[model samples]
Target chain A: MPDAHPPTRREVDVRGPRFAAWLTSAVLAVALLTGSGVLVAVQAAVFAVGALAGLRYAPYGVLFRVLVAPRLGPVREREPEAPPRFAQLVGLVFAVVGAAGYLAGAPLIGAVATGLALVAALLNAATGLCLGCELYLTVRRARPARTA
Target chain B: MLGGALALTALAAWWQRRRDGAVRGADDARGRTTTAVLEGLGVRPGEADLTVVQFSTAFCGPCRATRARLQQLQATRPGLAHLDVDAESHLDAVRELDVRRTPTLFYLDRAGTLLGRSSGAPRPDELTALVEAHVPAPGAREGRDV
Candidate 1:
């Protein structure tokens, strides 16, 4: 049989996601600091855009393309988009749960969830390790075998 | 709370630095012949002194870099072979081999014994050291450097 799966053809500069991760970390930090459900909700919307839409359409991604990419040197490396998109979905889940906890007057739950998201975003920003992306791979690997 | 969060993040970063991209001997592959697994993936174990089986997902950036590096190694090393497996499409082999993430590389000798495994992008010097230690010169019939 012909190769069933090929690497994703659409690629993004590695810097794009890293840049977005920095911005995400900052946003998540603020949300955690203020314990603001609204802020968490807003961040959730951002993640929703990235998850439901594509990473290319993410607000921070646009910011990177317009402002950051031009200032930096030419693209050094690129990567497939699926993993980060999956990461955004993961972030969205956390953000939604955090926002719900805050809105429901459960400060501890909100803090914990938002803190987890912040950690993940910070990891991506500082070290280029996407916890969500790693989770994505783990989930895929754990999936049941497709029946032939 | 914020201070606690930052400390936690720092701890995670430190842990990742210590763990990511380092190849370790595969305890799971110890003493087990992987000839069937390799054959299931259509790779013959006898063609080369060593075969590097890399499992990669589409979204993984380091996986691409790993592939390029392995391909480069294959070009330079006379008896080194590289096989790229799409982890998404080959879940069976992935599970059988206990692959956890993209760019998980399995080093196998000619008899299809799993020699080592790396879960992330490997360090260049360490990768070269492992290759030299495992893949003896073709047709020399020398024992492994171990």
Candidate 2:
């Protein structure tokens, strides 16, 4: 099958996504600790904005660009935006599920889903390795390559 | 709940760190899948003194980095070649080799023997050392033969 999404040429400073991950991890940690559906919902919205609205406009992206990027000096590295965007989508799925579970009184389900997202966020925050991005690549690899 | 997640995350991070870029000898379970896969890619055994076969996909960031590094290494070594295989396109080869992730690298010697394999972006020093050990210096083989 032809690639469903034509390759996007957009690239972002490599540090931007990592910075977002740090924030995400902290948010998820608080949500899990408090078992707060509202917190999970908020993070879900962040993930939704990131996956759908583009990273440049995402809240954490704005924070990184305005507050962090200025102090970091020149953009020494860049990466295509697709993988991390897909990762955001993956995080969104978990956050949404976790929110639903928490709000619906299924704390077990909430804990599981939220915990998974936390693990992924922690991986990205601490190591600059996105578990969601890795999952994206593995999923892509399982699909047939585009003929074109 | 938070403590459990933290513990799990810590364990995962430790495990991933241990495995990342660490080369291991070709396991016997793979049982000679390398030759057939290489041949399908138009490579015959012993064609190059050393071949670094890389399995990669389009969206993999580290795969791109690994490709650049391998390309640089190949450019510097007269007898070394780097082959980039689209893992998605070559599903059969990927399965045969049991490739679990992108940027899985197979290091092959002159006789096409699988020296080692590593999954994930390779460490620079280890990659360099592996290359030096496998690839002879310029005219070193010729001098030995003479």
Candidate 3:
């Protein structure tokens, strides 16, 4: 039987996602340190935009495509889009939870959520470790097989 | 707190890389699988000299790299077959094979006997060497030359 959700064949510039991760890491760090509800909300909005609109339309993605990629010369390889898109969804989950926590006056909850997201973002930015992609794979493997 | 997170992230990266792309021999007991399991993965018995059964997920970055490398090897090496199984769609095989991660590759001989396994994207040189070790030279067969 054919797989319903096959790995995407369409390639994307890997740098774009890493650049977005750098931005996300900075924003999440600020949100965690300052305990600012507004910052958390803003980060959440960024996550939402990235998750829904994809890297092409996301702010940092545009920045990478326009400014960074050209200076780096041609990339030898382009990665599939699914992994980074899944990572964006993971970021969205943390951002939404962090925003809610901040709005409810629970700074600790907000800090923890944002801190977790920051850790993941920093890992991607520094080491190219896509923890969210790993989580997505784990979840997919754990789920029961679908019956046609 | 931020410093601790950084340390943890570094540790995680180190650990992931240490194990990433390393191929090891499969345990004889655990690696044994019937032809039925191979059939489930759409591989016919004796179809090729060696079959690379790669279990992958849709959202795995390493899986893509693994696939590209394996396909490249398959293209150049005769009697090498590459089968990519989506773990999401083949949960039973995943469980039976005890695949805990994406891009887990099961190396099987022509008779469907499991030889080894690799959990992440294997290095191209290492992969080539491993395949060469398992597959006999062209025109060499069973202590007789064709």
Candidate 4:
């Protein structure tokens, strides 16, 4: 056999995802601390945009590409899009749940949801430890094997 | 609450980094034979004196780095083969190997016995040492170095 699998999709600057994670951490922190429905909704919208449009078009990603990336010079390494994209979907899940919790008059649920996302984002931003990416791998491992 | 989250994040990062790229010997208890598994993956036992089998997923960033480093090592080292397996498509092997993370690597000897396993991207020095310990010097194994 030639190989088990084909090459993955195009690579991305690893810094872009880290920058977005920093932004997500900040937004989630504010939402969780204030227990403000508006802030939660705004954070949820950010997650929605990222999950739906991908990091390339997301506001934070664009900011990184235009501002941060230029200052950092060329990156020697790039990573696959699947992990970070999966992370965005995970963020979307928590953000949407938090938004719904806040809108439904249950501040505790919103706080918990936002708090979980905040930890994941902070871990990625501060130390490059992506919990969401780990989760994505775990989910793949749990799924049934596909025909090779 | 924010302080707690920050502290927790720090702790998690510390723990993750501590174990991230470190290589350790495999457990003797788990001593599961991998010859059949290697055959299933199209790698016949004794095909190479030593093989570095890396289990990776599409979304894993460290897996890419590991692949590059291992391939580089293979270029200079004879009797050493590098095999990359997509963990997503090979769930049975993943389960058999008890791999919970991406970029998990299994080192195999000539007879396909699992020697050591490393999770995450291993440091270049560590990988070099591991390869050197298993694979003989370039000129020793004829026709094995390609």
Candidate 5:
């Protein structure tokens, strides 16, 4: 039988690192099937959720995909945890803060944490920067660069 | 997705923070006076910086916020300094920097090179970035006022 699935032309090529990014996102989505007060995984899921929200609510896809289209560039062989990596960092911090505040029964703290995280995330999407990335780079300066 | 929240944040949170007003025409008589007053202190290119000249007028509501933010940013960021020139005192600067908008940020490097400028209320992160890019690294020689 002939191959049922054939390669299709793309407006933006989703190959190489882009493909890895997409696949990792997909896998993360499947793994984070439950929100049940989960942390980092919930945010990875939030991107999926937010992308859908943007599609339905704003008629635009993810904010980064739309605004930073030029920066996304073509997929490469190397996959560095940079953009999503940073998002995960910020999101994880936000999750922890939120969880702690919730556990302590202080909605105010959770709200504050969410507020700050929102700033970092908004800056990333609008200004093409991630605060966590800067934080990560500064902290990891002493560590050896991973060959992987 | 993020933009949506930002849009809401601007409306709900930052709207009150925004100050609005038009730039005034120049007063040549006052321009020279400003330069003499601001010899050592730095200000935005074209816009003279005179700390003595604080610009808080009835017409300019966000003026204080802009000044505070500028002053606050200068504290954390390296070698970034600003001398505030009153929009009223130096109308000539208003004309030179084209301060057609109130609370317009006329940023300059420490030596007075006009690095970049924004004509509205600044985001906190944007303010940090502008300082990082424009401010002289600590211990670096200060260039002449550009």
Candidate 6:
């Protein structure tokens, strides 16, 4: 199928960093809700403050384009998706994992996993290599098609 | 950057794991260490007298079924084998083969010659006929797909 839209970049799309702050917010929120003691909550608060500080500085995309994406690795071809959708997805996974962990009394692990997922979601937003996208592609590719 | 690396690596690991879980049927993807599809199969082009290369996707259930079926077909048909390559990874190969759908089957004679192809789940009769026609009951024939 034809590309849904024409891509504009150096064979790689450099996305804005609104995603970074969003991820930090998501992770902090999960950590706070899942953590055991007051100290952990304080750490979450510190992260939130840091997130706010970063968000204030020319938005997150500036950080991503200037600092993050560069050090990650070379760009590769990837399909585009609505950016906010990815952020929301990251948030949702973290939230769900956090909740499940709390229920299972393994809140720390769940929260951490959720935080990790958020991190991945955020990175993918900037770099366009999210696990979800890869999963979708791998699943789609594995499923055989039949065309005459 | 560190966070991004972790994220990407986790995704890659998950991808590898998912592929690992796949059985040895259509586009197995598991144990496919090499990026090259043929090398992943642990087979060389010169080893088989006839080869059929199929470009496929992960979500195509029909492709999975076809792969399994093809695996069975290969057991009885010596000198014949198949390779399933991820079309996304090999865009050029897809274009070169003129594949338009998942599980697009490209056939080759014993000499590694591109003999024929089909765009869908081919019938057993069709595969057998193609093999019979191309190989022609053995003159110790040519090689196939690399």
The window of 10 residues in a row where model 4 chain A has the poorest summed lDDT is: A1-10
At residue B135, give the lDDT of candidate 1.
62
Q: Compose the digit string of candidate 5's lDDT tens values, residues A70-104.
A: 57665442222223333454555665675466456
- Against the true structure, candidate 6 reaches a TM-score of 0.34
Best of the candidates, lDDT: 2
Steric overlap count per candidate: 0, 0, 0, 0, 4, 22
In candidate 1, the residue pairs with backbone N, CA or C atoms under 3 Å apart (3 or more residues apart, or in different chains) clash, namely none
TM-scores, all candidates, are: 0.89, 0.88, 0.88, 0.90, 0.30, 0.34
lDDT comparison, 1 vs 5, better candidate: 1
Ranking by TM-score: 4, 1, 2, 3, 6, 5
Candidate 1 chain B lDDT trough over 10 residues, lowest sum: B137-146
> Residue B16 error for model 3, in Å?
0.5
lDDT of 6 by residue, B60-95 (tens): 323554677777777656667677766666554454
Q: Model 6: how far is B65 from its true place, Å?
A: 1.7
lDDT (tens digit, per residue) of candidate 2 on A65-137: 9999999889999988877887899999999999999999998899899999998988878877767666654
Off-target runs (Cα >4 Å) in candidate 1 are A1-5, B27-29, B33-35, B135-146
Residue A45 of model 2 has an lDDT of 100
TM-score of 1: 0.89
Candidate 3 residue-wise lDDT, A41-74, digit = tens: 8877877777798767777788888889999979
Can you give the DockQ of every candidate in the order shown? 0.49, 0.34, 0.50, 0.63, 0.02, 0.06
User: Least lDDT summed over 10 consecutive residues: which range in candidate 5 chain B?
Assistant: B49-58
* TM-score (chain B only), all candidates: 0.82, 0.86, 0.84, 0.88, 0.51, 0.59
Clashing pairs in 3: none
Per-model CA lDDT versus the true structure: 0.81, 0.81, 0.77, 0.79, 0.41, 0.48
